[model samples]
Target: MEAAPPAPPRPWPAALAIGALAQTLFSWRVTIPHQLVFDEVHYVPAARALRALTAPANSEHPLIGKLLIAVGIQLFGDHPLGWRALSTVAGTAVVMGVFAILWLGTRQLRPAVVGALLTILNFTVFVQARIAMLDGFMAAFVVLGVAAMLWSMRAHGAAMWRRWIGAAVLLGLAVACKWTAAPYVAAAAGAFLVLRHRRADRWPGMNPAFAIGVLAGVSIATYFVTFAPAFFYAAEPLTWAQLVPFQLDMYRLQTQILPPHTYQSSWSTWPLDLRPIWYLYEPADGAQRGILMIGNPVVLWGGLIAVCACAIGWVRTRDTASGASAMLWLFSIAIWAAIPKSLGFFYYFYLSSIWLPIALAIAFDRFGRRLRYGDEAFVLLSAVLFVHFYPILAATALPGPQAFTRWTWFDSWR
Candidate 1:
């Protein structure tokens, strides 16, 4: 019999412990001021409604996220801190989860570390984790679902069945978190189908039957869990309206507009980093006072190059992990911008931020081959810039001129 492929080596606990340190350092600057920065206004009310079991207006997103927020409120009291507690937790989870994904994908510890560290340094992930909004939770579910799917692919026999079921459940939970997750699910399933077709007749029928069952069960449970109270009422029972209001609320939120906001940016500029939304600004109170939110210029700029690298890698070698990751990253960023919605903003690209780290990891993988001085210099330069600007990007207060200079690309940001 052919020798079984050696199992992927697990990183030492010390490396994982370092990842925890990174998570704490990056996330600690979060939760300061304890005020709702942006979308918290909408989600906070929905969380409160969830606590009271009342159907609130504009609660169109999935309930699991709101329910998570409610749990935070239960722990922290129904204030800004309470509403925001879950966001921090979810953000941290995404950090760890993404690390696990990168580790699993390439089966390389170094790449996984790079991915996690880059994710922590990114402006979008940092700010979103600190705020009370659905994006952080949505990101957590997306990455988690993707990780489960990856694990499912590597499993076999009875183990394979279990992994498939897990993947479906996670994907279903992802959809139940945000309708935006639909594209990711489709991408994953599509990727799976393509891979299965390529490997047909090599093994037992690679039907995703167990996965489908788990997906259906989890989707229904996740949906109804939010409206169990509504179902309790004898007169109303379960109605399509209950399940859909959350979606409609999200739909309306995307398309509807109120008074023009100060920092709204067109979607077109997100990829170019031409416009970025400012989440918070306060006078410097010594070291702790400075805080502004934006995507990491390193990840933002280098990520574009990484995209090109990822495309080239896929074209040359047809590596699904590299190609799919790059495709998802670009899709996550551009697809939303392409939507004909009126109220789009730079922050809508927050979840898209996850891919920057993946892109960088791919770039690093390429670097290992040639190791040219220029490539090494480029990597070092990007790392320095990421570290240098991280404080400001994560809302670290500096003198006024210092802060404004970072706002180099100003058109869409204003």
Candidate 2:
């Protein structure tokens, strides 16, 4: 009974193929623009400071994301590639992570590929990953946590507990990148209990109290450990006594109200694609370069309807994989509506963006079976739309000004 999980037919071969392809897309001319884009202004410098043992620049966010950026700069030298190399890696990891979630949860190959490909060709992951930002690292680790959590409960093995602990540690790593990872920790813990509960106490480590405690304790401890480097900083070296107070300071900064910006958006508008952030739109290197953080219309907008279908399928069939996908998308976005953070942006939906493909794939696989490979056709449609908007998404050379309007179907996107 405990071995019901399909451990056979390893998903890695297909998942690795997807990762390799995604790597190529993520790294192609990733060093363009010859300078930082968007919030790279904040983080690249922060990374450099941390590398030099100076004061952390963006102290409001956690240190691991910047630490990775520091590692990239250390390996590649402080340039565009240095600033963005790890982001590309993290971004590619995200696409691969999405594939793993779908494949592991559903044990379906084609649907996994379709979902991952659609996510890769979208606007948010590509743009955010190519730039020096925390979302890429945050999103990547969240996926890793979800994948590990899924594997821990379902697969029967001596090391199941290790995988579960790894999931919590990864969640800590995600929050160490940004506070946005907090919700995912809860989601992962919740998922662990739910999956194990369905199987009763047949397994050896099915103790609910211990499971929750391990998740909570391990993740909190890991989050605290990430601040170790701060204690050694040459400038304003932090002591253990200051750690809790420092975290409180960061919390205050995160929730503080700030003057509104042109692109600031509410949580409700995210699914509607009403607000798009143009991270970079300036003439550079003899051509106009524009990189907009917007969702793929065919994938992002269509995904909402598909998510609803996934919810219905979950309730009727108790499809854990499909249900998990729906919950991830919902919890990721809905938390913003309830969070104390007053200011939000289109890119804040990056986590939700990650789950859309999984939800879409599950829905298409379940509901579109009647249409015969309808999921493939939907993926193809997403690819075509991706091609149509490649220039805007990839910071490519545009024909001229107002060319952005060609893809701006809605006035709000402008």
Candidate 3:
């Protein structure tokens, strides 16, 4: 028997170009309907206030997401395009990040391409990218951080340390964007440490304890640095003495639900796609338009099944890649499920959405190795679902209210 030849590396330039083009085509619409939709109303105003150096706005969330939005506002002026510019960039980064992570983990071109396409076409990523919200930026950072961690698992010496530090900073910024990203960061760190332990021979000089300490120190420092402007520019700026209490206060505020929200959905229904947040729905500019924040059913449902299969495969074969993908997905879902809130939204599923494509990619990679055109069929079905739901996802004006009902397959979706 002959040793099998190594597979050629993926074409980086072509993959990135495809990812960027997909992101630009899907999310870079500057003047579609021309109004703030959903949480854009909250975050955009916070960004504007940040630009004006006004009192801290949207105090419940951390400052980095607004800061990014503010950068867009400062550079582009406060318009639809201006507020959403950074989100567009972040969404694009997410596509590239997904590609990198899948490629690094599976070491195959087809899985990487399929996973990135699935992520790019996912309604959650696409719709969120078109708006100014913390979730898209948070999701992007999480994906990038995880990708860096995945890369670090294969590197050694200086390159490995740099990748670890990069992962920490990115994950820290993710937490600064939204606390919901914390679990994914934690899981990535755990994965990193485990990989380092398993491959200890490859990293003879690496000290796991010192490396984890560095990751923690850098992550916390980066998170606090993101709040520097908030501390510096607030009307009643907090001194070093008050900064700790301010964070504590923010934590307290997060737990205190002051009002009920009609659009809130329980975590239990997320995987089933039972409830979707109606980000926008009204008559605008002589036409009826709406933005429904819902995951594409084909991807979401298929991804869920794929995740389960990955879990089973990991248990059966002890495959590190499958195990990592399964753990990341399950942990992301568990974080949301464990949130003791009666008002969680479907968009809270954003973290799991980041890992779902990876899980699907893993499943497809295994199946494609055995069956011809398996990955292609899966990708095609996902694209078809995305196209079918594009009208509602993009707030496209319908011919009539009756036409709107055509997209609403389930009563709960309406």
Candidate 4:
């Protein structure tokens, strides 16, 4: 019987474990040059104000994201490193959450593992994770909520109501993290409703109305949990009419952020990485102080190509999983690209970084069909690529020649 073929290997647990481990390793790089480089100036001050109930009502972003930074300050002494610690953890959580999503989406380990590796090696993910920003946290919550919704779809038990409720609550949490999470919530909810309607025969006694009620409850509860501070304290002593306008004012402020900065690129050029932001750069007495920017030329360029390929493949194949993943990927990209009023930067797309891995996975899946390279080879190539680019991604002090060598791929990336 050929020794039963070793049971064909379980990929989910292994993928989850590998993703977790990679995230942990990546978290260490976060501590190098332990200081704020980019948006820390705005957020750190806001976090401090949050602690004192003096945060500006005119502030652009919502309170929940800043509150998350405050939690890191509450524990870690309110330094740059302390505030960024929250971002680091959130970034790692995104990796774990993405792994869970891949596992649930495909119900196979090979794709899950490939997805995890792609995520770990992706330059955008590396940059966002190691910085002090809300994007990482937003990404984490969005991915987690999507994973929960996917799991709820497949779960069948006496406690199925609990799973559905949990998924809804997670979606609400994602919303509280960032308004961009709306797309994920909409996608997941629509999918769930369709699945419930189609599978009524399999799920006997399942009432869509009752399920919707559960979702509503979860959404309310989660929102209250995240914003309890804002509601209970009433930091601003304004009338009810004034409060709504104040919130609108904040939104308006964010829309008109015309900051004069070098890396302030338009939305059209973002997908091409035409204007990469310089997160950090300091001079060295010797020739050691090279650029400490994120975005590996290979992965960034590869992901762009892979995205086009995935789009075409999705169109040709019409695989539901491929279509759904591709649609969500493109939707997130389109949303970021279409934001007309905000002073957009490269990091804004960090929340949708999950698409990077999906693109790469699709690329690898395509490779798997024609090439002799097996799954193990895919893993090995991913590891090699990650390691080769690890130093620059981590901002390690490399000699000028060494840094220049890595820049050989694209002058625009400089």
Clashes of each: 6, 0, 0, 1
| Candidates ranked by lDDT | 2, 3, 1, 4
TM per candidate: 0.83, 0.96, 0.95, 0.83
lDDT of 3 by residue, 106-195 (tens): 788878888888887778888888889998899888889988877776788899889889999999999999888777666765776787
- Quote the lDDT for 37 in model 4: 64
Error of 3 at 61 (Å): 0.9
lDDT of each: 0.68, 0.86, 0.82, 0.66
User: Least accurate stretch of 10 residues (summed lDDT) in model 2?
Assistant: 197-206
Highest lDDT model number? 2
Instruction: List model 4 lDDT by residue over 1-414, tens digit each.
Output: 556544546665786577667667756745566565667777777777776675353266666777878888898786656777777777777777777777776666667777777677666777777776767777887777777777766667655666677778777777666666766666766666765665564334557677667776777567546644554343654454555575577667767757587666676666666776667655433434433344544555666776776667768875556656666767887787666565677666565556767666666665446765654565576568767766666667776554645643566556
Local accuracy of candidate 2 as per-residue lDDT tens digits, 69-128: 999999999999999999999988899888878777777788888888988977778888
- lDDT (C-alpha) at residue 194 in model 4: 65
Q: Which pairs, if any, clash in model 1? A: 60-246, 290-396, 290-397, 291-395, 291-397, 292-395
lDDT of 3: 0.82
The residue pairs found clashing in candidate 2 are none
State the lDDT at 349 in candidate 1.
76
* Deviation of model 2 at 154, angstroms: 3.0
For model 3 the TM-score comes to: 0.95
